[model samples]
Target: MKIKQLKVRNFRLLDNMVLNIEEDITLIVGKNNTGKTSMFEAINIFVKTQEISFEDFSQSTYFIFNRLLRLINQVDFNSISERRKEIVEKVIQNQMPKVQLFIEVEYDVTNDSLINLSEFITDLDENRNDATILISYESNNSLSLLFSFLNREKQEISLIRWLKDNIKAFYQTKCFAVDKDSDFKKDIDLSFKSKIEKIVSFEDIKASRTLDDTKSDKNKTLATGFSHYYRERDQTKEDIKKLEETLTNVSIVLKGEYEKVLKDVISDLNNFGVSTPITIPQIEIDSEFNSESVIKNNIKYYYKHESINLPESYNGLGYSNLIFMVLELTSFIERFKNSSEEKKSEFLTILIEEPEAHMHPQMQQVFIKQITKKINKAREEGINIQLIITTHSSHIIAEAGIDLDKGFDRIRYFNKIDGRLEISDFNNFRHKESDKETFRFLKQYLNLHKCDIFFADKVIMVEGVTEKMLLPIMINNVANSLNNEYISILEVGGAYTQKFKELLHFIKVKTLIITDIDSVDGNGEECKTDFANAETCNSTLKDWIPKKNTIDELINCNEEEKFDTEFIRVAFQIAEHSNTYVGRSLEESIINKNLIFFKSEYTKDAINKKVKSLFTLINQHSSENLLIKTPWDLRPKSSSSKTNFSFDLMTFDEKETGLNWEVPLYIKEGLEWLAGICMVNISEK
Candidate 1:
């Protein structure tokens, strides 16, 4: 049964709170002292006492009062001469806080029905009112009919006979009832001697303990003896079964890691130097089970070696908090298999607290991957498990996208608004969650060059930040200070967009790409080039070039190859023609000084000179035309000249500059100009 809704009135830190739970795994996240745990306690009490009346849940009326007394911190009840007065004061003062629990459960009436055999017995209650509401055919539920109250009949009756035979209350809570003489606390304890007598397994185990009183004696008796062989065989079989169980669990965890959180988790791990090769060696999982089953209510556990050996409290609270996680999951799997189609229980709900404590950044991410993997696995298996977790893991929060509401069923946060427990759904476009700040910063500033002054309309996705920051400006100023039309220099987050841009483009977001002139492994880093400089580089047969940063160092190398490299030449040229330098060093101050020099008589001369310098030093030197063709919709770079270059930017203006101004820097006036008139398109029938 799925939880439709929950309400708590004066329960723990809760003061009349209600939450409508979604059918999917709903994560309940909040900080300390915010009533997250209290909600779970309310559910537990609600389920255990569902059949009882709301008034009977109070502390004053019956044996249920004992629980209330204990809650008031009263332990020993010894020398109290004023018992009745104290009890009255306690009852009036505490009063169990008046808890009312409501549950809406829909049962499958096609199979078994809830039979309250209690109703048939008439002698016990002459008043004949229903002490409980039990449904037979549940879909169209109606409260069971009641008269007044059941009273004992002077004559033998059906109630007496039935109570003597067929009914057994497996578990029950106490309630006050008016009786023939005095109120009674319904006694439910029964001796289990009959049932326990036939259970010989524990007795046999005890006997075996004696026969094996001395391990040495048992060993002697079993060695090369009939007993030894059988005992050894039993152990071998048990070990084999244990091994198989480990293998099965391994497959489950691995499938979750690889199939569910694959992309995100793998990418995060890459930052920690964990790659395919090292990952291969670490796949050996050391698992342990709670091999003991003393009361037969034993917990079956299988833990990873890293988790077991961890100084858990100190190192990874995320992993330790996860201990109960697998336990709850294993229990749910077992319960689902044994549940009747008609008698399903909502006990499958999982409540986790602070799944993000003390974990290293990478582990925080890894934990989310692991958890989502489990969620996916359960969903695929058709198990109706509702997961409610509280996390302090920022990585967990950040990785959850701002538009997470689309991907996730629901995402809510708990914070106090006017001194009350308040929750608000995300304002996705605002990107204000505690964890998404970095994501917004990167997606906004880093990916989309959002500077205040001198921003460009066109963006070129490049490999690194230095490339991202300097590429567009350098290209404009160095390539002849012309195409400064809202240029945005974007770092693709990586070389591969993972085909995510298919959506961005569908929205008509335009971007130019200037990759390593070598395919990346694919963080957008090109393979090492043999060329000494951009001049000698043959990027025609390669996908990457030396990074501009590395190129600067190479350009500054020993004067034996004295030459003005792109940066150097660009710096010196701008310096040569500037009125007042803008940078700290003359080298840096050059760019802002002279846009006129590059725009005028010197544009061709400067371009040809840089081109020759680039050609000379590239080991497999690429010609000028080839290098320029890639980032632009220009020539086939493999050709010898600029003969086939399309739309030469030698005279391209801001309007014709191939830049995207969708966000951060540019307004879309330039882009919408090409959308043509909307005059023809009409709303469809």
Candidate 2:
């Protein structure tokens, strides 16, 4: 059965969530602590209720959920004032921690007329529901986009069409699968126990009843002829030792004799100007060796074997996990109603949590490739493969390339910023995000494509869209005066400057930063000045730097609400401070006046019209798509603090233009002084 939709309410961290899930592979990812795990828990909780309780596996259900899953955010103590809010909301709104899931499984109707046309609303148990309705979105006005193969007609299509064409999905989780090994123990009951007990007896009875049981036939033959062989067999182990001694004797004689013959053969081949053959069938063993024996007389020519080392503790608790993915997959396998190619198309929803972990990078790729091959095999043999997995591995991410621009039908992105989840249909998305860094890297390094500087080489780092929209025009006029290359200046939803670390390695350049110091992390003072420095600072890699301040230091604003709102967080602080560093005037001009915006005059003629302008002064250049994502703390509509920022203002040009910055100024006097030192490297090649 295919899952059509999912609805979750006040279940742990998920607070009234609903998603329209497709039946095929669905991928989910987000930044840390942004409810990705909570969403999976909501799904597991619903599916898990139909199975056995946690006490059968762990000590208690709550213990597994709290200690194992760690679903609930632990508290030193929760006062009534805090906990009472939930109780009050229930009385007023009648809300409950209702974990609802909708799975629309499609099976062929042998008789279509038998379908209950009288509204299938009664399918769910109404007594348990707080409320129910189809979770449809208002923004899905592009009816043709949502459904497949429509001829401009918004009419409802057949179930056969939607099932065959439009089903999209994926299943993956992380962090919570640590205890998956024992999950199935809860589901094993009396019937499960009884089945196992009968298995041995049933196998023995079948073996005894069969006339052509193979072992019986072999036993009858052995009964008549085998006794005659035992006298030789009893003495053969000693024979093996004797043979080794003889083979050693023969080897010493052969080494002395064959040296002359082998030299003669090589001399003949070389004199004839001919290459020698690879295999020599007739080799001189020794005059002491017997050739006409049943086995090779020379024991040296036989087996030279060594034992392979294997891991001990085969059933140890490594692959055995808290989530029990393989065990859950067992249910999906058993749910197969038929083996027919068409009938068993939808059998299981496979959820994976970083299957790449504990595996080598090469092994991770191989494991995924092999499993996907298995999935494809299952699909052909009448089982639908629905995969949900998450990963920080770029090797894993490239498996599902963002071919959105190439008109591929499948793509989506889930980003976790602070405590919020931002999901978008990547197939329909158009934006410059940090993932583009990784995309640019892979395209060049992995795909071996030439870099397009508009997409790569040019590192654009600003705090928000405010700077993103404004800088290009300003750079066009001012950059050359200062010798800063007027590259594409864009914002990667940030103040997290460190995200650019890996990207710097790929493209071979450090990014220029532009940001406001945050309120907490950017706060100043030396050695024991900050709270993190009190204990955690000495324990971290960042200990060399005395203080890690909140970026609230850079902004010039005085308003406290600046921290709570977007667009204003950086610029608002700058405006209210009345201080002159990146002042309130420019801040108010961009934020309040809406003086900044990019209304895409986005034709290539418009983009490349300015694109060539960047090349007009360049000489040598190369670029790579590095898939390392520059993660950030500052996100749109988030109240979380912004930690850092970067401004990727310049880049190297290919020397074909005579604008290569790495060249010495003596030969290229036409180049301005500002064009010096922009290249990240100067190789001796």
Model 1 lDDT per residue over 30-66, tens place: 4445666666655554443233232222222233333
Superposed on all Cα atoms, model 2 deviates from the true structure by an RMSD in Å of 27.4
lDDT of 2 by residue, 1-685 (tens): 3344444444443444444444455544433343445556545544433321211121121232223112112322245465664544333222111233333333333322212211222233323211122211111112222223233244586432432333222111111111112231121222322222121111000101111113223222121112222222323367656865776787688877777668787565545633555543443334454322313221111112357432221211222221123323333444342333333322356655545444455555555555556566666776555665544444444444323343211223343333334454433423225466544433444322211211221334455654554444334433444224434343544334333333333323223334433322223332211224222211111211112223223222232322212111112123212223221222222222211111111113334443332211221111121112111101222222111111211232223223312211111121221233332222221
Worst 10 residues of 2 by lDDT: 199-208
TM-score of each prediction: 0.31, 0.33
Task: Give the alpha-carbon lDDT of every model.
Answer: 0.35, 0.32
Residue 638 lDDT in candidate 1: 36
Candidate 1: residue 648 Cα off by (Å)? 48
Deviation (Å) of 441 in candidate 1: 9.9
Distance from true position, residue 388, model 1, in Å? 0.9
